[model samples]
Target chain A: MKSILRLSVNGKPREDAVADNTLLIDYLRDALGLTGTKQGCDGGECGACTVLVDSRPRLACSTLAHSVAGSEIETIEGLSHAGNLSRLQRAFHEHLGTQCGFCTPGMIMAAEALLRSNPHPQRAQIKAALAGNLCRCTGYVKIIESVAAASATTELSA
Target chain B: MAALSDFRLLRPASAAEAVRLRGEYPASRFIAGGTDLLPNMRRGLVTADAVIDLGRIAELSELRVVDDRLHIGAGVTLATLAADPVARARLPALAQAAAAVAGPTHRAAATLGGNLCLDTRCMYYNQSEPWRDAIDNCMKIAGDTCRVATKSPRCWAAFSGDVAPALLVLGAEVQILGPQGMRNLPLSEFYRDDGMAWLSLAPGELLLSVRVPLADGWLSAYEKLQIRGAIDFPLTGVAVALRRTGDLIGELRIACTGVSSRPELIGGLDALAGKTLDDAALSGIDRQIRRGTQPMETTVISVAYRRRATPVLAKRLAKRLWAASA
Candidate 1:
């Protein structure tokens, strides 16, 4: 069975016929070619498939595409506006957050959702927000530093 | 990636419509959040010819206080519940338990109803089809003998949900809607000890909401032990809710999950009623909890570790509560 899915992905309107069993991750990566949203573990255990549904971080691998119709989805691919990297993305690059680069998209996406809601988050809040996104490399110190740095810069600019 | 079997998705807008769809598709399973159910289906642990999506039912996501009871809609996501000021103020244990669930992203999609109805998990039962096929499968999926205990005839898949134990301790009641009509039962009655048939709901019944009684003079705490800080199911989860009148205990409830086939309220705590929480009294209650709970070798951590740690955790929680009261 196929269902018509209407969603705003990365601020662009997308209407597609998705299978009944198609996961949000599969829809983003395979169907729409939004490969920036990585799929790791495929179960909800790892947040490698993290995406913003209605501006809240959700695991794409576990969410059914049909369930999230008419919602705005922000992904790692959408983080950059024009030719500029997002503040969080820049902080990640500056702090050496990406080691293997597999968990970067998800970590950044989760952090994006965090900073969207709480712009000036503390270090512990950043850790709690990125707790779902796991990075096997860097031992999470650099990733935490990256999110902290981004929050600090955002705090300063505001 | 494991492919889900071919199935028709049914999105029902209301509880009545959901019930009707469930009746029409008796073999179909309800999908909310799809965190636990979808993964199980992917692993071939569960399959359905039709999936009744409960996400579209807006009423199931309501969270409010009505008639002095906190009515938490079944579809209210774990993340929302954890961050809700009312939930933290009143049912703090439940809020903490919701936060203690698998990470931030899973909590965003995983609903309270989904967690309460989470599938009983066994290390042997949660593997991929090929992985289970290699082991000849366990009693939870296909094979007869219990993999946790070879001679046991029953499935020993442990109940790993973090929220159920907290709700059970809080004297919460579940509002269920079915073809027969709406009925409410204590959350304690909602669970069965059997792993395969863990929930006590009827075939077409859907959990609509959970009603948690106002914790007027009560202090509650929930502590979970897992291998990692995140993304892992609790090896042992302990939830305690109690009220004290000066030095004497008024009412007490101690509950635990990830220890047995079902999250259970440790009985005989009524024995501690009208008594002060001395070390001897606590040790006695701790011994009772340790004796009553039966942690099986069905999860990631060793059963020995879980068994030994349950009472220690309970005692520690009780001490913290006492300290707070003081």
Candidate 2:
């Protein structure tokens, strides 16, 4: 069945009519043309498809489009404004967070969520928050550094 | 490819409404989180026209304590159930089991109801129908003689719900609401010994909630015997609950999960009442568990390894319970 989902993406009201079985990842990439969110291990293993649903990081591939019908969703493409990247997004580039770029969107979204609730998180807390995400190529040394750097940067700005 | 995009999805308000809708569309499957259902649907393990999402059902999403029991709605996520203060304080076994299911992301999405009613899994049968047919099918899907037990008449698939064993020790009751109205029965009575027909639930019937009697003066814990620390299903999971007084065990309930099609409770093994958890006592319990289990070749891990680990799990669980009680 065709279901029209009305959701607040980033900071705007976005509505899309999708099939009942339309996966949220595909809906974001195809319907909305937001391909920044990479799809890896659509079975919800690798956190490559992670996106913020109501400020909580969730796997977009495993989530159905119909399920998120009156909820707020945030994708990587919408994380930035006009022509500038978010602080967390830039921190990844500076901290060597993105090696293959497959897990960047998810890593950034997870870090963004952590910093939203906690601008200054301990190293152990940051690691726990990113436990679900997998970065096989980098061994997660840089990703952890990226989140820590973002937290420190957020702390400095505050 | 064109999707099956013409079916209407109904959002029921309560268990009663869910039952009513089940009556209306007897073919529609009730969806709570869809962690299990969606994957099974993609594999064509279950076929359904409409997905009646129960996520919006307000009455089915709560975790409450009533009188002497902890009631967990079917829609309660594993993550929430693991962190529920009342459940954590009263029934630590259940909380521990919930925490060990899948992973953080999976726990956030997998619901307690779905975990309890998890589909019976066999290495061969859990695959796609086409994949099964390619091998001339196994006993669970098509062909007659059991591949695992060979001469056995029935299939030997494993029932592997991480939270079930803990709840079994807690002596929980299941609240199942269906087209025939609602009925609450002891959780132990919910399953049959048969693998293919593990659950006694009727088709279209939805498990609404699970109620566990609070552990009083007793301590419990769940131990998973798997390779990985986070995302691993135990080849043989054990839940042990023992109450001790002075130098004797007051009450002991040791159960096994994934050892059989349905979680098996050792009958005469409960004779551990007032028995001391000495080395000899532990050995006797291990012997009994070894004699009772005898896991077949059906699950992912080797049957020999699982069988060997069963007794080890029993002994370890006994020792842990004894130490905690002491």
Candidate 3:
């Protein structure tokens, strides 16, 4: 039950033969070698496998590859351009947002979605947007700071 | 990670086509958002020889208002439903309930039909396959005994969906399509008390849309007690809709979830229709809810806690809604 899936990933169009039951996470990690989307909880409980499906944050582990055949998917690997870290990525790195870095990719991806729609979100808005994602290291103070710092920087478009 | 078993995926373009496919593949399961069904499939709680993806059916994604009733297609995502200005303004309780589902990401993909038809859950039944195997499985899955109440003949899994109680209070009606044809039924009649067969859908049946009547001048609210502020199912969820007339109770409806196998409407409230929502009426409503709820050991939380908390939450919602109407 494999089908040829035509989708746009990281702004590049991809057409690959994926199994009918292949999860989006596996399709990104195993098929395309996009390991930036981590699978912390195999199920949807943990937000570690989050990716943007058509500019909205979605759980990759719960989505089937074929279900999003024509969707525009953005992963953590798509953030950098011309070897320069995206503003959110730079903020996370400078503010020590990554202690173990397990949840950073998903966190940043979720944050990227939030910042796109709302450039100047409040602290409560950031917390609500990332509520689905879980981070065990740094107690989330640095993560919040990282997103806030990214929001304050007016040089680049989210 | 639990691997999902192999199954043929069928995508249908219309509701009629989806129903035809269901008739074609009797063992097929309809999947809308895959938020609830996919996880259950991974846990080995459900199996399907073929999965009918209803996400592509355009007819089932319509959300419109006609003749003072909001017609919400079954495939409408929770996020869309929550953000709809009409839904937010007309049925604030339902919008609040939809917004309060799992989280931002889950609500993005989770649909109204999936939430309405959510599987009943129990602490023992929702575990991993191997974990359930260690306990020899419960009646809801494989074995004959109901772990929550071993002596009982039926499963005691609690209906944990947050949207059902809100819809029940709104007096919603569901449009169902089956081999026989389309028929409408009150949302309250759509559920049964049995956890294993909670929904009243016949074979080859599909929920098409939900029609909610626009209740004018009625203030409503939904409240729930969850272990976490987000990403947790309600231990006890209560929804109240009330209209006030000259500082007296005009109309009142209360419904609750997470305490029984079905999201139930709290009865015996007609007596309080004209009575002002004073402290005495609130206490009376609280006692009625406490007496109506029959929680079992379906969740990690104790039955006593749910029993006590269900009434408190209902009373609080009633008080809040009543005050807001003033």
All candidates in order of lDDT, best leading? 3, 1, 2
lDDT leader? 3
Best by DockQ: 1
TM-scores of the models, in the given order? 0.98, 0.92, 0.98
Better of 1 and 2 by lDDT: 1
Question: For candidate 3, what is the lDDT?
Answer: 0.91
The CA-based lDDT of model 2 is what? 0.79
Candidate 1 Cα misplacement greater than 4 A, ranges: A155-158
Clashing pairs in 3: none
Q: Candidate 2 chain A: worst 10 consecutive residues by lDDT?
A: A149-158
CA lDDT, every prediction? Answer: 0.90, 0.79, 0.91
Stronger candidate by DockQ (1 vs 3) = 1
Interface Cα root-mean-square deviation for all models? 0.9, 3.1, 0.8
**Worst ten-residue run, lDDT, model 3 chain A?**
A149-158
Q: Candidate 3: where is the Cα deviation over 4 Å?
A: A155-158
Q: Chain A TM-scores, all candidates?
A: 0.95, 0.92, 0.96
In terms of docking quality, model 2 is acceptable
